[model samples]
Target chain A: MVDPKLLNFDTLSVHAGQHPDTDHGARAVPIYQTTSYVFRDVDHAAGLFNLERQGHIYSRISNPTVAALEERLAALEGGVGAIATSSGMSALFLAIATLMSAGDHIVSSSALYGGANNLLATTLPRFGITTTFVNPRDTDGFRAAIRPETRLVYGETLGNPGLEIMDVEAVSAVAHESGVPLMLDNTFATPVLFRPFEWGVDLSYHSITKFIGGHGVAIGGALVDSGRFDWTASGKFPTLTEPYPSYHGLRFAEEFGTQAFLIRARVEGLRDFGAPLAPQNAFYILQGTETLGIRMQRHVANTRAIVEYLSGREEVSWISYPELPDHPDHDRAARLMPDGCGAIFAFGIKGGRQAGRKFIKKLKIFSHLANVGDAKSLVIHPASTTHATMSSEQLEKAGIGEDLIRLSIGLEDPDDLIDDLSSALRASRK
Target chain B: MTELLVRGARVSASCGGREPDPSLPLLVFVHGAALDRTCWQLQSRYFAFRGFSVVAVDLPGHGRSEGPLCASVEEYADWLAELVEAAGYHQAHLVGHSMGALITLEAAARHPGRISSLTLCGGAAAIPVHPGLLSAAQNGDDIAYRLMASWGHSRRSHLGGHPTPGLWMMGGSIRLWERTPPGVLASDLAACDRYRRGREAARQVGCPTLLISGSQDIMTPNRSANPLRNGIKTLAEVTIEDAGHIMIVEQPDRVIDALDGFLTGL
Candidate 1:
């Protein structure tokens, strides 16, 4: 009976959620590719359906391979449980759908991934749910925005593209003061850099498509529950505290206790939404997670080297990496993410949008993609791509400048990366 | 959910989705230290739907029940006896786990006629608390939770393949402990430590007793239950392999099977 708390993060990343296959003794997690499981008998089948026992019945609800990923993510995040989804967007949507009903509201950071912004501002409004967006740095703004109908307060660990650090502890305090749970999108920081739960966050979701799945192969997401929120105490979340008619009047909080939220997300959200991660994708993501610790260390180191290079370059006008003393959130980032401020940052070129385009076009080592957290370096000019539709004034309001070029540093040799950027910088200036 | 007024405190119990029927046999589930009725979710629901009435209780000051913590196992036993009667049961088949096993033993010994049968899961004749663990819990340090969760579960459970799909057993256990109010764990540990009349209680219990042990239970190994096995004249025993102290969640199905077989025979 060894104490598992003694196991370190790197060790858990490798061995947390899987054991060798009993049937074939396979060392790697076997992909249980089947869609359904056969029951032992009629009684066993009944027991499973009624929640009288624990086992998988359908792949959409749960699968052995997917379960392994779910458990591993839960362990890594220090969460009680997790649910894996087909994409990062689905994980976000599932949580929202499970927690919010028609006539409910959310308080969110104005700076968010474009997809998330659209989901909260545009799409969910069609479903009768509204959002109030505030600056991630404004802790008081979050509290002031909370309505009696507000059920959740949300933000990214590091604001998307702008590199603004969220004061998680202060904002989480505001959320809890108003009797709402603080939720964080931890796609940029991953648990290696910042564990949101330890900073008073109640729930966190990740785009496993990013850092966790370091290689740019799989597109998946996961939502983790810290299981510290008391749903019944607030009486705001009837979906969890009251009887759920969908599952034979089972009261999630009563029967599952701290696990109520994640259980409801899986049993109802996945059952209806039907956006489960494929077993093959889960296997790929699991493999990526095994090397997460080492990969993140290199990613942070390489990012530091690039930030230093960009700071001294004649073709660069400004930099937004938080570790730089001039960045507005430098002190906050140092406190929250002492290891490193993560691998993604933004900087301004000597020229504007055209220079940004030229610099991206000339780069040989960095791929020009609308994504971050890949093993290979990635460069995206948000003004001409993700935020291209925004007017100059709108871009400024959102903290994205026309001259801003976002860089997601990778595991490549620093010298080769610096050389590639140097040639591209010269081309952009000319 | 059912609420009963026992000794002026509001006691909460899960009735397993059905109201107690006077004509049906009664099953009462008691959870271990720092845990609640949710631990008995599977077993209680199974029996509740299968021709029996179930009451999985949250002991005073635990879960939904309101209280100043019970100071000793004998006090908790007396409270349980009152709760059973308040729920309109004359006799019940009591099922207890770890600290809960001690409570059931004391209850059966004190009021022999009220308990029809006994099932002690992870029971021991004596439980001696570690001084360091007691101090840690007394100060409300989270290390107490980590130690219990890591040691309570078998090694295989750490790499979770939970019967409940997508659940991390060890992580869930820690979260459950975190939900308990401060000082409750220390109080429960103290009560378990102070309990010293297991052999006398076992000798006095005339009900058909079943002793369920986990093969890998380091917290309270099978050998520790030797006094109960020897004292209880009509005792039957079952050992679940590869299970640790918290077998109720670690290997729920096996624990259920053992209970189902034993209760059906009785």
Candidate 2:
């Protein structure tokens, strides 16, 4: 039988999660612009709240447009379900909060977005939830970091600055052996380039603000549950396995089954914190997603040209891209994300921090920004911007050299991007 | 949720809490051929919270359940009886859809005292198979699945309106069939066509029965099930409008309301 899920990536991007709006015949997904849904009756309302039916009640809990985006991402990632959130950080927070409570712990990859690093190193600790950070290259460190109180193992699909490509299958094995689920932040490698679930990673999230919403017009996030992980077999997550006071003591795992992680994130995390993606944002994200497959193709091709150009430039000291043979994870990237490692990578210039700032100022086409995965080319000195507050020792540990320049390649003509970087590099040296 | 290895077949189920009340009778949901437990997800969760132990199985060779596909309805019924017993239940309320209904009917006839009550959806006792469909399935042609998915739904369902948000009924129905192994459907269709015991099986059912018919269901419409209904001395029938053979996805609320009322009455 031809599997419905076997449809090619390009086909699913446009047609996966939605049908035309039945009420008005809207071909495009409608923005369901309302705060609450009117129930069929009071009994219907009770049924929705009681988890006896599957339908929208409150916008904060679930909205039609947002649900469509959630479903689209789920289909893209081959997950049981997905929950769209206000931002990438909220998606990460929701996953952590749903899986754990006060007095719990986590093992995480230190090579992460600076914001996420702060959350795990600083903010989560204040909430009585602590983390043990492991070097992204150190698989043994991740396993050894686990304590009896550990809830999950967290890592990035591509580590910061250095482009550390995780051996997802190997790391997941260690996690499963200890009865824990491995979660990956797949913002850098969108589902078009890589699906973590295919590599045995149980849960994953993406910053829709990145390539997914290619135009960078919306700020949103998606949390995907692979449905392959057996939470019951782990016997550690009481939040999923045990009954709760809310919703008449319904244990999510027992009732929701494969979609337990997703349902819990929506009802408990989104319901309480109320960090939901606006229907408008969801619509924008969905529109961007329709072209995600094509956009990533251009993004990757353009990046390769830029990488090759920089390698030959005398003003460039070193290049850090997974496709480069000398890079530590080059072979792994070829195996895992064979289509492309990603469009974003960091490199160093002949000069130090001063010249890096000069290079950023000289570039006319490359916007100076902290964000990656935008349609317009962007450049930044990560050590000065994203990791400015971390101590020198912490900076060294994160592999963020003071001279490193991170570039987010765009869909512009490769000649223009390479020329713009070439002139900027010469100008910085002069 | 429970995953058990019952006599070599992997049985995946959803029940009440970690441990359920033995006094409260169990309701076990069986899916049609070429579909798994996910089709019943919406209903199972609802019933789990409604104070009953609800179990929806991914019959052998489907979804997470492992198997060398049973070639007949009787073999499937025997497995169901053993699964319930393995889960420590003496009796259960059997809820079946399409091919699943034939299995339940056979189980009722074979083990008269094990089933407390029976609920059949989108099914008829003598479910005759289309010859072309059977031939295509037997050949394991990919086109067979596409035809089954497209022809199985009512015109309204083909137009793509699902009661639930973020779900496409046509896409969902197609995926369910595609998820099953190649030759399972052909064998199941053959088993249904050979079973000519609708009236006899219905007479042996010694408990109340509920029949949920889709008003527009071309696969097993109300007309096809008339004889089965006549055989049941104690029975109730409900026909939901604008729904097809997959009534659960088309009008979940109405189906649940009718089923809930009947179960509550019992």
Candidate 3:
């Protein structure tokens, strides 16, 4: 098998997990929509069922299109193998389920996406697994939060809307010292800008909804295993080390080696939960991945221009782009994401809620929608809509204030966008 | 000649009631900002049996009536008058809520010849300016949750711990307010600032007006009702005992009773 780390992302996107199909000579991956794949014989089926063989038996376990996406993602992310999931939340759920069971604990960053934050801080406690949330930038914070039962340390590479860049290497160091793995959500900072594996991350997940699809048409997620973590040696991941009653005593780590985490996630997690991505959605995302390089480059460029434009406006009371010269995280951003910061940033208007409402209403070019990652510009007020369920205290803790307006820059002409925003700002101020 | 349409401007649908009647007296409803003509669903249908034509109009940038959203209540009223004229109604009864009620009063003030009577539900001659709301909106919390928290129900109404759709109403209200074009809200609020449609405009209205207020309405209280009562020389009043600012949804029965009694006198 070819090592993905050796190749460039642009090249890997097109060629990974894809070859000229020998039977049909199909260049494009054909969607194998069938529920089950037939075997050569009863022995072949037995081996497949017994986990002794490596062939597709059930679509729930894996589909050809989903497998292609998995392989392509694994290659792009520099991981040994990957698992595609129904949604981003499901991917996080599966990752937690695969690694930690009852009595286990997780250490995570406090400044997380609201949904993820709620799930970790509030929801997971209901399931008997307590989570210790600390600042991702604190290398010692991760270490201190870890209890004896801590199985993982998790954080997002570039925190959503908050845009706080995590020191992945520092967190990884803390996790490694305690015989644990670091999982990073690389959805915002796609491999195009920053690959987490390069910073010693053991696992990375993506909410393919954002940036990856480049369009907000399909909702999907992926989990990429770095294959560097020795689950058997760590002895912390019992599912990987212990005998499997489901597959007739087949130990995952010993049998599948680097591919153990992904295989188990597919067969045990996805198969039981039935959260596999549809072949059509996988196809849509694949098309989106094809233009990843160009889209991300333009997204950064447009976002920088927008940040600059909004910062200088008299109507804008505050701006929260990390790339701003005086921003506390600018230096950290420079050291971490040297290429450019991600496309999302938040700003406040001078007139407060009324002015903000007027500005959004006056916007002719930008679409007012909850979704992001569309080829078109999108805007939202986090406090009033997405984070409306959270209390003011929760919003403050997450660094989200009511005045904050998030902008997801798209591949539009930056000048036109600036003009539209300028007109709206001028109108709002009056 | 009173015509009603639900999804379009200048046409009237049968006041949607659970009854089978074609010749009901029309209760033409004109909704305020953040709501379409569909807001009269409960009233129109409930009173459809009383031989009433329940019709509602979507003001410009409101429901099906599309345009650059109006900047002021006067502009919305002006548009409502034109819609009434277009519907070929020489005289029709009117009911409005909040900003819609403000616009309805403005419409009655502008085109008295086209209106038979008016019902202002949870309305006032003036809206008090909230600095925190304007500040928060200007600063981009256009969703206006804090504003909703302050302006929605009276403190007593919200003492219950159960979550209700009223929360979504606050969210919806903010979204609707925020999603307008720039200067639109400023213009609307500015219109409110410039409005002096108290006893004077009501007196000039030259038609019977009914003022229905929610007891718990923070936006418009019984004190504000003094303006409508003093203005419309021919005016009646009904206070929804325990309702909120959005009395139509909060106290539908009281609203209907007020409208029923007021309309019957005609």
Candidate 4:
């Protein structure tokens, strides 16, 4: 069903989520900053409350702007449905809460984001749910970690900072054998680069704070269900098949069909947590999403240029960008992220930590900041900054060496960036 | 107000600066020869927000610190070590721009135990003493300003691209080189001339180091950076393509990138 003339990323990005408003003639999705929607009468309220009709009840449960974002993200990721949340962490929490309960377990990747790592490693244990972290690329490790009580096998499509590419199909095979759905965090890769659902993942999540927003102006997250996992057939997901007393004995799988997991996450998780995305933030993210395809294209191109420049420099000790010919993951990055691996990468300084600090002091164009995925170029020393809280063992496991520097390539002319780096290196050496 | 005497001058003891997050590392900024501690205004604020304990000091004779300009780089390194120790940063991310870069390298070499990382900006291992420039300064032809103006910027740079000059004076001590004493200026330049830390010192630095230079830096030209660059066993270099020597003023963004990459990696 692919139309050769119509199939392009740019076209999809702009038109994917657009639809005309039937009543108000509003071209743009209006920010429905509403708390509760009034029902026509007692009978209408009863029908809505009893799951007899589809309508918004409260902003915490759903909103027009957020719904548009959810629909757009779901379409972008080719998922059946999506749920928006206050932050990426909240999206993860909702995803896990919807599928598992006390005594359930998860097998996750060791290279997850710091916040996600903390959640899975420390926080989830309090609720009697535990997670086993394995090497991201080790399919056998995932299989070994899964127990009968394991509800999901999770990994980031491209792990945070480390940029390890997970073999989705391999991991999914191990998960399916245990009747556990494979959940993937598509945050770093975004749907534009790698859609995990197409690679056998049953669910996907995004921390829209990074590349998805592009501008670094808003914070939001989303959970998208692929609708391929059969909860009734699995039997392990009793939460979807059994009657839920919270929603008037409604069985999600029986009632929602392909949208069971997503609906459950929204109605059960977001409804209870009250971690709904603000209408303003949702609108901002939607704006960013519209130009994502092009932004990512430039980001990748710029990244490749910087990586090549840094690799050739005599003062640079090492470069960890996967696109480089010398990189260990060069073949894998090319296969999975052929357009480009990403705009971000890690490189070690020749002078180690001291030279790193010097080089940073001399840079003229690149901004030293914690946030990534801005329209501008960014840099940070992970060992002394973001990963300072992590122990040396933890840092090494994440591939964050003391001398490693992370650079997020922006859309500027690559020559300018290279020149800036070249000058910074020259100044640093003195 | 306990003032520690260094080189027979009273300098404010490095007081614990702000909120202390035990996990976060400490950063000590050493200003260039002409500029005082306040040259690091934007950096101090930015790094502090990111959760680092930042301490910047007025070099001798430049700000409130008491001392005469001594024609020796060793004394400068000694003073820097004193400041680092006083700040309670036994080991720190030492960020040195231009003249500060030379001081930072020497200090790291003399007291290797105190520096966790080194960032050198617009600096050189050996600054060739220009005969004409040296004569001009000795003759009181106001050569320091002319040389500084050249080193401080590229012809294409505009003040609008930079944050206000007032931002450069946020810290308690700041004196744009134009206002600094003539003897102090001469002594600073003489100290740079005598300053020969060489490849051995760069090799001796035990921690990670980053080398940053400006493409248009005529003061410490790109070619002169080899000694420091080649000496270091491990180094990463970031060159600001369009920027000149005065990187802190000209291209704060690129400087920020190098800082972010180096700091985060650490």
Candidate 5:
């Protein structure tokens, strides 16, 4: 009986969520690809349905392989539980839906992945849930944004594109003072680089499609509950504290205690919304997660080398990688994420948008893509791609510019990446 | 959730989504120290739906129950006896885990006619708390919680494949312990340590008894329960493979199955 508390992060990454198959002596996590499980009898079937027993009944609700990945992510992040979703967008949507009702409100960081921005600022309002967006650095702005109906304070660990580091401890304090939970999108800085729960963060979600999955082969997301937040104490979340009429008037907070949010999110959110991660995708993501600790080290090292190389290039106007002393959030990043700031960062090309286009076109090794956190290096221009949905004013508010080029540093040789960038910078010159 | 008045204090118990029916055979569940009724959610609800009327009580000063913390297992046993009567039951099937098992044993011995049957899960004749653990818990140190949660489950449970989908068993256990009211855990641990009459009480228990053990239960190994097995008049034992002290949550179905057969037979 080895105690899990004594296990190291690396050891847990590989073994935390799985064991040797008892049915078959398979060493790897077997992908349970079925849609439903066979019940031993009617009593057994009723037991599962009534939450009297612990077992998977339907695929959309829970699958064994997906459950393995959910547990692994929860262990890595130090959360009580996790629910995997079809995409990072779905995870965010499910979290918002689970917490918010028609008249609820949110306080959010202005610097966010564009999809998240759209969801908070645009789509949610259509359903009567409103949001107040503040700069990630303005802790006071978050405090002032709280309405009586405010249920959540949202931000990213490393802000998308801008790479602004959130002061999580400070923001979480503000959220707590207002009786709200702080949720961070930890996709940019995976658990390998940062565990949000160790700080004051109450909830966290991820796009496992990126770094966690390593390969860009899968698109998945997960919502993790720190189980520290007192939803009952908050008194604002009726969904958790009050009896739910759907499940025989079961109150989630009373029934599940610390795991109230996650259980409700699964039994209600996943049950009705119906966006679950495929077993095959979960298996692929699990493969990537096993090597996360080592792969992230390489990713961070390569990013540092590339950041240093870009600083000396005359074609580069500015960089926002947080490790640089001049970067606005460098000090905070150092204090919070001592292991390493993540690999994805944004920089400017001297010749503006046209030059940025040519530089991206000229790069031989870095693939131009709409995603980050891949095993291979990737580059994207947010203004024309990811953030294209946003208005010019929205882009400016998010600190995105025409010349801004985002790079997702990979595990390739640092010298090779630099060589490719060096030639692209020269070719990008007028 | 049912609210009962025991010893002039409010006591809460999960009645499996409905009020306990006096018509059905009463099944009362008692949770271990520093834990509450939710620990037996799966079992209580399962039995509640299947012909048995279940009431998994939150011990005084634990969970939603309101009262002063019991100073000893004997005090808790007195409270348990009164609780069954307050819930309108003359005789009940008693099921308890860890510290709760000790309480059930003492209650059955002291008020034998009130308990129709008794089931002990991860229990021993004597549970002596380590001095270091006692001191740490006294100070409300996190190490006590970490140690308890870590030692309570089997090594296999550390790597997750929780029968319950999406729940991390270890993390959930720690969180539940963290929610324990300040001073409550230390008091409960002290009470468990002070308990010295378990074997004697076991001999006095004349009810049909079942002892449930987990093969991987490090906290209360099978050998630790030798005194109880020998002392009890009529005993039935079931050892769940690869389970630990918290077998109720670790192997819920197995625990339920063991109880179902034993109680149904009675």
Candidate 6:
């Protein structure tokens, strides 16, 4: 049998998971606005509910409009399957819920977003799952942290705010040797700049609200399975390897093979958690994904120019970017994501905390906001905003500095963004 | 939802539960050439719920089943004979697809004691491999996988509307075939091509048999499947329209309903 030709990524971005509605002859993906689908017959309805067939029974489980976005994202990432969630936070939670239950553990990078850090350290323990946070730089710590109960090794392609680079290939080796999957958060790098799956990371997720969505308008996330992990071989994840009593004695691994993890995440996690992506939001993300590659290229190009401008300024006390030659993980980032390190990173101001706030307040064009990856530039002071409730020790442990100002470079002209930063720096000084 | 290690062959299967219920009839599902047991997902889940203990086997050396690749369809059949006993079942109702069907046909004929019956979905009395396709698999060319997957499904499947809501059936099938380890596909294709005993073995089989053929199947058209009807006694044929070789996915509901109905009658 000859194989069907697959369109390249750029082309797939435009067409991968969609086709014209044969009945309606609509050119664009119609919003499957309804919550339920009409079954052809009683047997057909039973077939869908029992997972004997693959049609949508309910929007909360799977919807056509959202399925289009999910399939497109899965194609873009080269994953076997994907489950779209309400937000990146929900995606991570869904992944964890699918892989483990009470008594299981995870080893994660200490350098993480505040919300993730809290979820791992505090919130999840209340649910009986626990985490061991490790320094991403200590490659050995990842291996050493593995316990018999450890189900996954977690890291980000680019650590939030700090831009700390996780050695994916190196960490993946540790994870595989320990017989657990490695899940990476690739929101910052996106697939255009980096794909953790290529480095042997078994699963990856994105806050599509960021690069994949390319706009801050939609708050959604996606979890993708590389279809590479062997749960039965590992003999650790009973969740995937054993029949779920709640789901009618259905065994995910036996039923879905390589895609067992993702199947369970959708069948159990999304169904029970009820954090399904709205069809409207899914369309918004789909529109953004269509031009992800081009937008990311422009964002990276503008970012490098802005970083260069900031590095030469007297008002900047220090600049932290993996692209900087002197950065600790510069070589590693270059090897893993040659396209770019990321569009968001942190920098320290010469005048410290008070001046850092003034500089952000002084920017006219760059909006001071909590979100990132918008077409318009944005700035945030993590210590006062995302991490305000944390104590000094907690903030320091997370690598968040009082003087650090985080910038998420946008698609604006590089010179305009640079000029705005230049004026803000001058206004905040003496 | 657990791993079952078949003794001696070191072959493993993804089983539906921690332990197979002895009182229940065992349904062993084998995959097509260059594919894994996951292809039978819809059937396995449905059968498991229908009071059958299911085990989707990753043929020796494919998927999770560590392989010293079985040299021929006969060898694979012999291995299944042992896997049934090793899996602690008195006998198994064997279901195979494509290359797997050839193996099941041979096993039921040779080791009838370990097999309850046979169900061949998308199989024929003889399979002739395209020379270029065989050459591609031999070279471990990924193009061979794509070619096989593209031709495996009907044109309607190319623009997919799988019963499953979100899956791009064609893309999923391509990715599945691409996961075959080095020489597995080449060996599997050669085994199917060289197997000369399918029609002869069907004549020797002393059990009920079912064939679910796709009306639009280009790989094993009606002409290819006709010889089987002449060879087997008490045989049944159910044809699903608008489906190709991969009818299990292209028209999963129809394929599944046929099996469910046949088993219920049995």
Off by over 4 Å in 1: A1-5, A388-394
Chain B TM-score of all predictions, in order? Answer: 0.98, 0.94, 0.79, 0.86, 0.99, 0.96
**Candidate 2, A1-430: lDDT as tens digits:** 3332245567668866677776898999899999998888877777788766878988998898898888788768766668899999999999999999899999998888888988998899999999998888888888899998898999899987678977788889989989999999999999989999879898999999999998878999989877767777788898887887896677776665566777788888889988999999999999888999999999999999999989998888889999999898999999999999899999988779888888998999999988889999988888778878777887888899988999999989999998899889889997
lDDT of 4 by residue, A378-398 (tens): 899988887777778887887
Q: Write the per-residue lDDT of candidate 6 for residues A1-430, one digit (tens) a residue.
A: 4544555678767776677887989877889899998998987777677776677888998999898888777777877768899999999999999888899999999888878888898899999999998888888999999999999899888887898997788899999998999999989998888877778989899889998888789999999888878787799988887668876777677668777787788888888998999999999998998899999999999999999999999989888899999899999988988999878989999888889878988899899988888888999999989777677887886788889999999998898898899999998895
Flag the better candidate by lDDT, 3 or 4. Answer: 4
Q: 3 or 5: which has the higher DockQ? A: 5
RMSD to truth, every model: 1.5, 4.9, 29.0, 31.8, 1.7, 3.7
DockQ of all candidate complexes: 0.62, 0.27, 0.00, 0.00, 0.59, 0.37
Best by DockQ: 1
Candidate 5 structure lDDT: 0.91
- The C-alpha lDDT values of all candidates are 0.90, 0.82, 0.71, 0.73, 0.91, 0.84
Question: If you score just chain A, what TM-score does every candidate get?
Answer: 0.98, 0.98, 0.95, 0.94, 0.98, 0.98
lDDT of 3 by residue, A243-306 (tens): 7778655466644445567767877998787787888888889888888988999999999889
lDDT of 1 by residue, A1-430 (tens): 2233546788778887788888899999899999999999999999988888888999999999999999888889988889999999999999999898999999999878878887888899999999998988888889899999999999899888887877898998898888889999999999999999999999999999999999999999999999999898878999998888876788888877888898889889999998999999999999999999999999999999999999999889999989999999999998999999899999999879788888989999999998899999999988778877555765676698778899999999999999999999999987
Using lDDT, give the best candidate's number.
5
Cα lDDT of model 3 by residue, B45-162, tens digit: 4454456655555555543344566667777777777665555555678898877788888888888888888889877888764665555444555434335434655543332111
Q: Candidate 1: what is its chain A TM-score?
A: 0.98
Cα deviation at B143, candidate 2, in Å, is 14
DockQ of 1: 0.62
* Cα lDDT of model 5 by residue, A1-430, tens digit: 1222555678878997788988889999999999999999998888888888878989999998999999999989988989999999999999999988999999999999999999999999999999999999999999999999999999999998898877889999999999999999999999988889989999999999999999899999999998999987889999998888887888787667788898889989989999999999999999998999999999999999999999999999999988899999989999888888999999999999899989999999999989999999999999999999999999999999999999999999999999999999998995
DockQ of candidate 4 (2 decimals)? 0.00
